[model samples]
Target: MSFYLSLDDVPDLARGAAILGTGGGGDPLIGRLLVEECLKNGKKIEILDPTEIDDDDFVIATAMMGAPTVVVEKVPAGSEAVRSLRALEKHLGKTADATIPMECGGLNSMIPLVVAAEAGIPVVDGDGMGRAFPELQMETFGVYGVSGSPLAVSDENGHTCIVDTGQDNQRMETFARAVTIKMGGAAYIAEYPMSGADVKRTAIRNTVTLALNIGRTLRKAKDKHLDPLAELSAFLKDTIYGHGTVLMRGKIVDVERFVRDGFTQGFATVESFDGGHEMRIQFRNENVIAHKNGAVVAIVPDLITIVDVDLGTPITSEALRFGQRVAVYGISTPAIMRTPEALQVFGPQAFGLHEPWVALEELSAAR
Candidate 1:
């Protein structure tokens, strides 16, 4: 069923999207505020189920590219989203009939709502990645052979670039990252234009709804004084994510962060409150690896998230602070992400880790 996303839904949507971000995807605060501002200005955003879209309809996926910290400093002009879409449509010689989020995490998930509201198009409820990844080419759409070419990038300064990188998705990311760096570290992009039929086949189905449900579940759990972690695990187990395992409960003891090539690169260490064990996590915008007591417990392509043990709020890679109590959770990647081709693109090897890929289920069993 189709529904209008009102101001009231933004909080849950943003919270859920952040959780899906797996500690990357940028912080949801700026994106959530952007959507709220749009709503306050009387903009209406409608979300349509993928099944409602016609097979031939044109759908463009949109998102912000670059460091989340930079985005917070340089606020969007509010028109960047629609402007990028229009630029892409001009390049394609067809107006987008609808829009979809390239990823369903932190800022990108809500950025599409801003696009749909401004462009007067409905957003498909599905997204490219059920959760968020750090890179543009990490999505199911790219894995399923959708070209990332003819992309349009727009900055807050009204500068726009329409790029055609042919069939090389990696090249497209390279070009876009350079452009984003040149644009003062952040820019909105409209790329991966696909038919509704292709979107249905490649996109992770109903992730928007799933994110909303997750957010609502967390909020409800808090209200009822229930264990939020337990609630989240139950919710994930019933969905495509399969089981959610609590990897550890600890306090952040150390952090090392720096920006390289327009991306946030960092690692954090968490020590158990009792000081019996420690966990180390490496990240490039997202949590890419986790080590429990000196053993690799989880790695890329599997979802690694950290939440505040008290508030149940997700802790983004950029927001992890020393001395904060957190619970680390690991969830299984979608079935599509486990395929050999997808693994080649997102597995541990893709992240320069020499270790073989380990499924979250197996990791849980070993635990």
Candidate 2:
């Protein structure tokens, strides 16, 4: 099914994307404001289900790449996203039929929307990564054997460049990261051009709708004076994600974060209210792993999210601060994301963590 997004839908979508981002993907506020700017200018944004696209339709993923912390300071120049998309189309000698999000995140989720609205195309209601990751090749399109070449990147100063790194997706990410740093730590990107048939096979289906439902669930729960975490967990259990739980509730005790290599790398420590238990989360743009008293509790491909304990509003990694009362929620990734092939691309080892990848459900059961 397809759906249309009015101005009224932006907030819920941004909120949901933020949670799914699992503490990365740039700022939701920046993305929301940009989308609103496009809407206010009379552009209509349409969202088509992945199934709606014809087999040969040209689709591309659009996103902002760089450290989430840097994105807040270096705002997009509004035209960069659409400019990159057009540049990619020019290179391919074909116009884009639709745009899709590179990942499910605050900034990334809305980048495709902005591009679609400006380019007069609809957005596919799905994404390359079901959740956000720090690097370009971590997306399923790359993991599932899609080339991320002829990638277009645009900076705020009206400069656009194309990088065609053949099938070496890691090389593409390396070169792209260097360009992003030179562009003042942030740039808009359009990559992983695919036919609709490829999208149906590689894209994580219905993540846009998933984000909307999560935002709606949190809002309704809050409105009805229900426990937002409880309601959210129950709702997630019935979704493709299959499992959701409050991993820990505590105050952030310490944070060590820095912007380096065009990425935000850091860890945060949260201590229980009674001070007996502690959880530490590590990140490289998005949360990668969480250790509860030195035991692996949640790891990547799965989602470890931080939210305001009372309001259920997601707190991105850049926003994690000392003394904030927060709840760390763990949710299982879809089966496709947990496959052996997918893990080799984005597992704990990929992030330099030594622990073997473990499912959130199994970890919870062990606990």
Candidate 3:
């Protein structure tokens, strides 16, 4: 828990984090970059185990909400992350003994580190979601009946709203998204008030260590020109959840993004260079479903990633475009995401697809 991770170690951690995210947390790049910048400025990220805290110590999960697309255009002023957590502490009437990274993907993962450093608290080494997802309530926190209400969200312009929604994490999510859009499409949020024992019961533990291990492995693979994918598969062993072929390779032809019901909804078309197939990828901040050559190929609860094979970098759902020869990879999902409630909120049907929700791995293996 005392280890200080360097900027170079972020990718593997993020990759592993994404797997844990289980197709819900947002992208990890923004989070990695933010953490890296903090380290560059001589900031140190402290990791803590839930057991290290006192039973009654205050703990909170933190993340960002709004359009991931808008975040690139309007970079946070660096202080916005910490501001939301600090504000929440004032509202809760106690100093947070530790800051918990709400989820382990994209910007949310780094939000708490900055808050922790500024507050001089240790950042809990675990997170609510192992991977990324769009909805606030779709986490182990949900599994344990942790309502994501009573949240504090803030924008760069210094607009802060302390919400007390009781049990309506979804409605709270909707409300926060609206405010975030009006404020320019992205804002930081502090949510899920919990204690140490509750933290262990509801959180995914030691993910930071797993992330560090994965990051280190990927770096070694890169240096050795080893097949990063294969190395990862071997390293993960039983944990590789899902795997699938490219289905089809192509450049992105078009993208349609719009904010509705407090979520960014859209899709992209990848015209296969092989000239015989095509891929249609759909998402809501997080990649949820993908189709190939007019055939439904992949669906949520699983992970679909479009990596520039040559660059070994992931393409954000927004940056996906036409004319780039890309390789798409699919990962198996954890069984929990298949829960009816989880799927109703993020499945293929949730994205407006008529196909009955089918797990991607099943379809991929069948192919």
Candidate 4:
């Protein structure tokens, strides 16, 4: 379908996108602001279902990769996202019929709205991964036997890298990460290239519509002072439900952050709300592990999200701090997150752990 999305749809779409993010889409607030700015400047975004395009139509996925903390602080260079799209089109020897968010979460979701509007192309109502991941080659496109190589990664400075390792996506990941390191630790990018028809079989259908709905629900719940968490639980419980645990309802006492070797690293401790219990959180940007009383409770792939009980919003791993009262919720692992390949890809061991990774499934069943 040849349709353009407007600013009015941002709220629901962004919210719903967060839900599909299932606990890991970076953050959407800044992306919404940037997208709205683009919209105000006479940009237009079109949305299309995967089936709407011909089998031969070229499809690409775009997302911003880097420290989410850095993204919010710097704001995107504005034109970088759109320019990357245009640059890829020129490099591909074919203009993309559509651009979709590489995944439907955080800033990536809203980035496409602006990119599509500026480029006058339709944003396909689909994505490579239904949720966010921490790697370059971890998108569903790879699972479907598609390679991220032949990828064109462009930054805000007109510096571009044409990547085609001919079946080596990890090399592409390494190459892109090196670029990201030089791009001030955050770079706007559009990667996966596929056919409208080819992606339909692997892409999550109607996710954009679902994201819009979730956003609306959260908004209504907030205005009414209803439990936004409850509203979210009701909306996605079946697909993303996990054991509801307070983990350690506490106040953060200290936070230590260091940009070690160009990547953020740190640990935080939260003293119990009851003042009798305490917990420690470790991270490499996103929450990776949570421990209470020297016993491991919540682990990766499971939602270790910290939300302000009163504010009803999430606090990301990088931003965890001192003197903040928060509730840690244990949400189920995302569908894509549970895949053996995925667990292996983002497993605890992969992140420099000496211990074997604990499967979320076993963790869930044990309780």
Candidate 5:
């Protein structure tokens, strides 16, 4: 089935994408406004289910690469995403049949929509990651053997770089990061060209619908004066994301952050309202670990998200602040991410934590 996305869907879609962003993916605010403007200008974007695509359709994934903080200051030129896609298509000697989001989180989710609208191509209803990660190589597509190359990076000033990093997705990511930094810290990117059949086999299916469902659930809960967290948890139980657990609810007491390697690295401490217990979250774009009273509570490859308690809105790592009251939730990642091979790429070890991988369910049960 195919469906069109309108301005009316932006709010919910943005909200849901933020929740799945796991504290990264940048702020959805800028992306939302950009998308809304496109829609108001009479542009229409359609989303196609992965299963609906023909086996040989040429699909390219597009997104922005840089610090979320930088993306806000250096907004896209409104055509950067499409430009990058077109550039890559030209380099590949073929036009893309459709566009897909590299990941379904924060602003990246909206980028593909805007590009699809401008390019008159349908956006695939799935993504490389069901949730967000900090690096380009951390996608399910990459994990399942898809190359991340023949990429195009475009800046607001019309500057673009066509990259063919051979078989090293990591090298592609490193080069792209450096290019993004030099391009003023953010650049629109289009890469990972793959057949529709490959996408069906590797991508997380129905994630766009999942994000929409989550957004709608949160909105409906607020309207009905129900517990949005409970509603969110209930919805997760029925999805590939599995169960969601409230890791802690507290006021932020401290935050340590700095920029290194063109990325934001940091840790935040959230103390209970009564000042009794405290939880610490470490992050690299996305939350990587959670520790409560000196014991590990949650780790990477599982989803760790911070949400405004009252409104159910997700707060990205860049936006976390001291003195803010929030609730942290741990949601199980997709099953594909739990495999031994997948863990090697995104596990705690990959993030520099010397801890064995543990499932969110097990951690919650232990708690």
Candidate 6:
């Protein structure tokens, strides 16, 4: 089924995007504001289910490409993504039938909505990555078979570059990162142009709806003065993302994050209120690996998210600070994302972690 989003849904969507982002994908607040601004102008955004698209319909993915930390200080002009989409359309000599999110994390989740509204097009209800990933080539679209090239990168000042790397998605990331850094450490990107058939086959289905549902569940739980974490766990058990586990409930003792190689690279340390336990999560934009009491509790391809203990609102990686009381939750990724082919692109080793990838469920049980 299809649905429409109004201004009222922005907050819920943003909240869920942040959770799914696992501390990356840029700030959801910024993306939320952009979508709100669009809706405030009386424009309605429609979300089309992947199955609704015709086989030949052209779809393009839109997202922010940069250090999430940098995005905290540098808000977008809200037109950068639209510019990149238009530029990509011109380069391909074909207009996009609809826009899809490159990843369903943070700012990237909302970017396609903004672009769809501005371009007067609908958005597909699925994304390349079910959650967030830092690199361009890590998308399931690339993992399954879609080429991310003929990609467009644009900055706030109207400069746009189209990268045609043929089949080299990694090279696309390399070239695009250079342009992103030159554009001031952050830029908007339009990549992975694909047909409706490819989207149906490769894209994770219904994640936009999933994000909205997660947000609604948390919001409702809070409204009822219920345990939001427990509610979130129960809600996720039925989704593609398996279960959610509370890795630690504590205050942040330290956070060491900085923009490195066009990515926000760092670690955050969370200590239990009584100091009985500690968990450290490392990231290259998105939370990749986490250790609790010196043991690997969760690793990449699985979600490592931090949310407010009281409200259950997600905290992005760039926003982590000392003394913030938070609860860290580790959720399993979908089975499709754990396959041998998928792991090679986004698993623990892909992010430079020497340990082999382990399912969050198994790791949590062993602990």
Evaluated at residue 291, the lDDT of candidate 6 is 91
- Candidate 5 is scored at a TM of 0.98
Local distance difference test, each candidate: 0.89, 0.93, 0.69, 0.69, 0.89, 0.93
- Residue 280, model 1: lDDT of 95
lDDT head-to-head 1 vs 4, winner: 1
RMSD of each: 1.0, 0.8, 3.0, 3.0, 1.0, 0.8
Worst 10 residues of 3 by lDDT: 18-27
Q: Estimate each model's TM-score.
A: 0.98, 0.99, 0.87, 0.86, 0.98, 0.99
Model 1 C-alpha lDDT per residue in residues 238-292, reported as the tens digit of each score: 8988878889998999999888899888999999889999999998888889999
Off by over 4 Å in 1: none
Error of 1 at 266 (Å): 0.7
Tens-digit lDDT track of model 2 for 9-96: 8998999999999999999989999999999999999999999999999999999999999988888867898999999999999999
TM-score between candidate 4 and the true structure? 0.86
Enumerate clash totals for all models, in the order shown. 0, 0, 20, 5, 0, 0
Tens-digit lDDT track of model 5 for 143-234: 89999998999999999999889879989999988998888877899989999998998898888878888899999999999989999999
Which lDDT tens digits does candidate 4 get at residues 254-357? Answer: 88876553345678888887789878877665566778787677776565667776654667655667888877655555565567776666667766755565
Once superposed on the true structure, which residue ranges of model 2 sit more than 4 Å away at CA? none
Candidate 3 TM-score versus the reference? 0.87
Q: Which stretches of candidate 4 lie over 4 Å from their true place?
A: 1-4, 12-27, 51-53, 238-248, 354-367
Runs of candidate 5 with Cα error greater than 4 angstroms are none
